[model samples]
Target: MLFAGIDVGSTTSKCVLLSDGEVAGAALVDMGIGTAGPERAYSEALAAAGAAPEDVACCVATGYGRASWKGADLTISELTAHGLGNRFLFPEARTVIDIGGQDAKVIELDAGGRMANFVMNDKCAAGTGRFLEVMAGVLRVPIGELEALAAQAEKAAPISSTCTVFAESEVISQLAAGTPVPDVVAGICVSVASRVAALAKRAGVKEQVCMSGGVARNGGVRRALERALGVPIVWSAQAQLAGALGAALHAWHKSEGQRGEVKYG
Candidate 1:
C-alpha cells in the first residue's frame, strides 16, 4: 500500500511517498516561507508519486510543526522517526547524530539498530544551524561559502561563548580585528563540532555512526566533526529525508491493519 509522511521542521518541511518499503517520491521546501506548506507538501508528494490522496492508505506527521497541522492518521516524534530511518539506511551504524535547524541530537543505537540512549539540546540556539547562520551573516558570507573558506584556514579564532548572541559578538570582534574570514569561519565550525562532540561523548558515541540532518550537508562541519570525533562518520544518502521516510513506512504498516506500532531496530 502507498503511504505518506510530512515533516514540518523549523526551517523547512519535507514530504515523502513510500511505495511498499521504498521511497517512491519526495520533495523538500522552505516552509512558513509559505502557507500551510505541510499540507501542501503532502499534496505535492501525492502528485509526484502519481497517486491521489485516496491512494495513500495512511499518513504520518512528524517534526517541530507536527502539532501545528491537524493532518495525518498518526503523529510521531522526529526522534523516533529519524532513528528508525537512519537504521534502515545504514544497518551497521551504532550511533546516530542529527543536527537539524533548531537543535542537535546524539542517539546511541544497539547492534540491532534500536535506540539505546539519546540526548539533545533544545534550550538554546547554540550548536544549531541558526548559530552557523548568524556567524555567516556577521561575516558577510553565505552559508555555503563558509565551509570552503573554513577548510582553507590555517588558524581558527577562539570563540569563547557558546550562546549564539555572544558568539556573534565574538565574530564581529574578530572581523574588526582584521582576522581573515576563513579563520573565523573555521573557528565556528570547530566550535559547533566540539559542542556536538561533547553531547556525543555524554551519550557514549561509538564508531559506525550515521549522521542525518540538513547540517550534515556542510563539508566543513563534517571535517571538524571528523577531527573532533576521531572517526570517519558515514551519512545516509537520504539524510534529510530519513525522518519523513520513516514516518511514511510507519504509515504503511498501520494501514495494513496492524495496530501494533512498528519499532525499528
Candidate 2:
C-alpha cells in the first residue's frame, strides 16, 4: 500500500511518500506566511515518487499546521511522530532531541521503541532555530556559516541571556567589546545547547541519543549538545525528515488496523 505523510512546521514544510513502509520520495520547503506549504510539499513529493494523489492509500499530517492541511486522513502530534521516525531510522535510539524552528523537544523511548515520556520548550525561542537566526543576523553572518565559524573559536564567550531579544543585544555588546565573532557565535550555539540539554535531562535521557529537526543540521549546536549531555549523538541524512517519515509510518500502521512493534526496513 502507498502511504504519505506531510509535516507543516513553523518555518518549513516536509512531505514523504512511502510504498509498503519504505520511502519512495520526499520534499522539504520553506513555509513562509500561509497554510499552502503542505500542499506544495505534498505535490512535489508525489511527483518525485511518480505517483498521483489517487494512488496513495493513506495520508497523515503532522507538525504545527497538521490540522490545517487539506485531504489528510489523520493528524498526529510531532512528539509521537518524531519518536517513531527516529526509532525507525536507528533501531537502538532510546532518546530523541528535536530542535525545530520555533521549539525544542526531548523524548524518551521505552524498550519497545514507543514514546514513554517527553519534555518540550514551547514558551520560548531560545532553544530553537529562530534564536540562531537572530544571533546570525546580529553577527552579520549567514545562518549556514554559524557552525563553521563557531568551530574556529578558541573559547566560547558568555551569552548570559535566555531571551532571544536579550541574547541579540548581548551579542551586539560583545562585538562592541572587541570579542571575536567566532567566540560570540560559539557562545550562541552553547547557549542553545544548554537550554535544550535542560529539557533532555527533564525527559530522562538514555543511551543512543538521536537529534532531529532543522536545527540538527547545525554542527556547532550538535557538538555543544553532545558535551552538555555527555553522550554521543547520532544523526542521519534523514534527520530533517523524521516527523514526516513517522507520520507516514503511522498511516501505514493505521491501514493495517494494528498497534504493535514496527519492523524497520
Candidate 3:
C-alpha cells in the first residue's frame, strides 16, 4: 500500500511518499500559494512515487499549512508528527529539537515515543531559518555560502538578537564596525543556537537530542548547538523530512488498519 505525508512549513513545504513503510518519493518546495502549498508538495511527491493521489491508501498532512491540504485522509500537528518521526528514526531519542523557517520546537519524548512535554517559539523567527536568511543577506551572500564562512570564523562576535528586526540592525552595525564577516555570521549562528538551547531547556531536554528540520542542515548552527548543549546530536539523511516522515508513519498505521494488522503508537 502507498501512503503519503505532506508538511507545509513556514519556510518550505515537503511531502513524502511511502510504500510498505519505505520511502518511495518526496518533494520539497518553498511555500508559494499559502495554504495550497502543502497540497502541491503532496502532489509532486505522489508523482515522484509514480502514484496518483487516489492510489495513496492515506495521505496525512502536517505542519503550519496542513489545514490547507486538500484530499488528505487526515491531518496531524507538527508536534505529534515530529515526535512520531523522531521516534521512528531513533527509538532511543528522548528529546527532539526542530528549527524550522519561522519557529523552533523542543519535544520531550515519553518511553513509548510519545510527546511527554514540549515548548515552541512560534511567535519569533530568531531561532529559525528566517534569521539566517536575513543575516546572509546583510553579508551580501547566498544563504548556502553563510555556512562555510561561519565554519571558518576564528572567533564568533557577540550578536544580541532576540528578534529578527533587531538582529538586522545589529548585523549592519557589526559590518560598519568592521567586525569581520565570518565572525559576525558565526555569531548569528551562535545567537540562534543559544535560543534553541534555551527553548530545549524549558521543555526538559533529555539525552540523545535529535535535531531535525532544514535548519539542522546548517553546519554553523549545528556546531554551535553541539557546543551549547554539550551533547552529541543524532541526525540522519531524513533529518529535514521529519514531519513528512511522521505523516508517512501515520499513513502506515492507516494502511495497517486496512490489513487488520496490530500496530503500536
Candidate 4:
C-alpha cells in the first residue's frame, strides 16, 4: 500500500509517497499555506508515483500550515518531522538545523534518533530565508545568485544589526560606501549564520550535524554555519523534502499497524 506525507510550510508545500518502506515519489511547490499549493503538490507526487490519491493507505501532514489541511490522517510538529526525516537520511546525525522561509530551528537528537532538545526562532525573520530575500532585493540580485556572488568575495562586510529592517539599511549603506556586492553578500550570510549559531549553541551542538529546509541549499550559508558551529554540516539533495518524508514515514507506520503487519526498525 502507498502512504502519503504532505508538509504545508510557510512558503512552500511538499508531498512524499512511500511504498513498502521506500520513497516512490516526491514533489515540491513554491506556494504554501492559504494557497492551493498542498493539493497541487500532492497531485504532482501522485502523478510521479503513477498512482491515484485513492491508492494511499494513510496520509500525514506537518509544518506550520499543517492544521489548514483537513485531509490528513494525522498531524505532526515540524520539529518531530525534521528530526525523523534527517535521521532517516543520515543515521549518524546527532543534530538537525533547519532554516526555512520564516524561521530557523536547531534540534538535538538522542542516541535513538528521537528529538532530545530544540531551539527555534520564529519570533523574527532576521536569520531566516526571508532575510536573504530582502537582502537580494537590496543588492538587485536574484536569491539564487547570492551564494555564487559570496563565493567571489575578497572580504565580508560587517552587518551588525540583528533586526531585518536595520540590517537592510546597513547593507544599503555598505553598498553606498562602494563595498563590493560580493563582500556585502558574504556579510549577509555571516550575519544569518551568527544568529542561528547562537541558537545552536543554546541547544548544544553535536557532531554529525544535518541541515534541512530550503536555506540548506545555500552554499554560502552552509559554509558560514560550519564556521560558526565549528563542525561540518551534512545535507542532501532531498533536504528540503525532509519534513514531508518524515510525515510519510509516520503514515507508513500507522498504515502497517492497522494492517497488522510486522513493523521494521
Candidate 5:
C-alpha cells in the first residue's frame, strides 16, 4: 500500500511517499504555506512514485500549514514529526536541532525516540532561514552562495543585533564600512548559530545530536553551531525531508493499525 505525507512549511513544502513502509519517492518545492506548493509537491511525489493519489492508503500532513490542507487523512505536530524523523535517520539521536524558514526548534528525545521536551523560537526570525535570506539580500549575494563565501572569511564580522530589521541595517553598515562580504556572511552565520544555541542550551543539549530542516543544509551555519554547542552535529542528505518523511511514517503506521498489523519502533 502507498502512504503519503505532506509538509507545508513557512517557506517550503515537501512530500514523501512510502510504499509498504519504505520510502518510494519524495519531492520538495520552494514555495510554501498559502500557496500551491503543497499540492505541487504532492503531485510531483506521486508522479515520481508512479502512483496516483487514489493509490495512497493514507495521508498525513504536518508543519505550519498542516491544518489548512484538506487532503490529509490526519495531521501531526512538527515537533513530534521531527522527533520521529530524526530518530529514523539517526537511531542514536538524543537531541534534534531544526531550524526552518521562520523558526527554530530544539527537541529532546527519550531512549525510545519519543519527544521528551522541546523549546521553540517561533516569535522571531533572527536565527531562521528568513534572517539569512535578508542578510544575503543586503550583501547582494545569493543565499545558496553564503556557505562558500563564508568559507573564505579570515575573520567573522561582529553583528550584535538580534532583531531582523536592525540586523539588516547592521549588515548594510558593515558593507558601507568596507567589511569583506565573506566576513560579514560568516558573521551572519555565527549570529544565527548563537541565537539557536541559546535555545538548545535551554532545552539541554545531549550527545548524538542531529540537525533536521532546510537550514541544516547550510554548512556555514552547521560549523558555527558545532562551535557554539561544542558537540558534533549529525546530519544527512535527507535532513530537509524529515518532517514529510515522519508524517509518511505516521500514515503508514495508522494504515497498518487499521489492518490489525501495527508495528512499533
Candidate 6:
C-alpha cells in the first residue's frame, strides 16, 4: 500500500510518498503567508509519483505547522518524525543536529536507534536558517552565496553577540571598519555553529553525528560545525526531507496495524 507524509514547517512544507517501504517521490515548497504550502507540497509530490491521493492508504502530518494540515489522518511531533527519519537514513547515527528556519535541535539516539535525549533552541533565530537570512540582508549578499563567500575568508572576524539584532550591528561595524565581506560572512557561519554546538554539547553527542534541515545544505555551516564538534559530520541529499519520510514510515506502520486488526476482527 502507498502512504504519504506531509511536514508543514514554519518556512517550508515538505511531502514524501512511500510505495510500500520505498520512497517514491518527495517535494518541498516555501510556505506562504497562509495555509496553502502543505497542500501544494502534497499535490506536487503525488504528481511527481504519478499517483493520486486515493492511491495513498494513509497520510501523516508533522512539523510546526502540522495543525494547519487538517487533511492528515494523524499528527506527530517534529522531534519524533525527525528521529525516526534520521535513524532510517543513517542507522549508525547516534546524534542528530537539525537547524531549520526558526529553530535548532540536537537529538541523541540510543544504541537501539531510539531517541534518548534532545535539546532545542527556539528562543531566538541566532542559530537557525532565519539567522543566516537576516545576516545576508544586512550584508547585502544573497543567502545562497554565503557559503561561497565564507570559503574565501582567510580569517573570520569575531562576532561577540548571539542576539540576531546585535549580530547585525556587529556585522555593520565590521563593514564600517573596512573588513572584507568574506571575513564577516565566515564569522556569521562560525557564530551559528558555535550556538548550535553548545546545544549539541548540552544534549551530549555520540558517534556518527549527522545534520539535517535546510541549513545543513550550507557547506560553511557544516565546516564550522565539524570544527566546533571536533568531528566529521555526515549528511545526505535527503536530509531536508527526513521528517516527512519519517511521517510516511509511521503511516506505513500504522496502516499495517490497522490491516492486522481488520483481519483478526
**TM-score to native of every candidate shown:** 0.91, 0.95, 0.93, 0.96, 0.96, 0.94
Ordered by lDDT, highest first, the candidates read: 4, 5, 2, 6, 3, 1
**Could you tell me the C-alpha RMSD of candidate 3 in Å?**
3.2
Q: Which stretches of candidate 2 lie over 4 Å from their true place?
A: 32-35, 257-265
Best by lDDT: 4
Candidate 5 stretches with Cα past 4 Å from truth are 257-265
Taking every candidate in turn, the Cα RMSD to the unseen true structure, in Å, is: 3.4, 2.0, 3.2, 2.9, 2.9, 4.4
Q: Candidate 1, residues 15-50: lDDT per residue as tens digits?
A: 888775667778787673246677777777777788
**Each candidate structure's count of clashing pairs:** 0, 0, 0, 0, 0, 0
Q: Residue-wise lDDT of candidate 6 within 1-265, one digit each (tens)? A: 5788888898899999888577787899988225688889999999888998889899999999887787799999888888878888888999999999889999999998889999999689899999999999999989999999999999999985379989989999999999999999999999999999999999998989999898998999999999999999999788888889889888987888521110000
* Alpha-carbon runs more than 4 Å astray in model 4: 257-265
What candidate 6 gets wrong by more than 4 Å, as runs, is: 257-265
Look at candidate 4 and tell me the lDDT of residue 38. 96
Across 1-265, the per-residue lDDT of candidate 4 in tens digits comes to: 7888999999999999988777888999999899999999999999999999889989999999999998899999988899888888888899999999899999999988789999998599999999999999999999999999999999999986389999999998998999999999999999999999999999999989999999999999999999998999999889999999889888887777532221222
Two-way lDDT contest, 2 vs 4, winner? 4
* lDDT (0 to 1) per candidate: 0.80, 0.88, 0.83, 0.90, 0.90, 0.88
* Candidate 1 C-alpha error for residue 145, in Å: 2.2
lDDT by residue for model 5 (107-159), tens: 99988778999999959889999999888888888899999999999999998
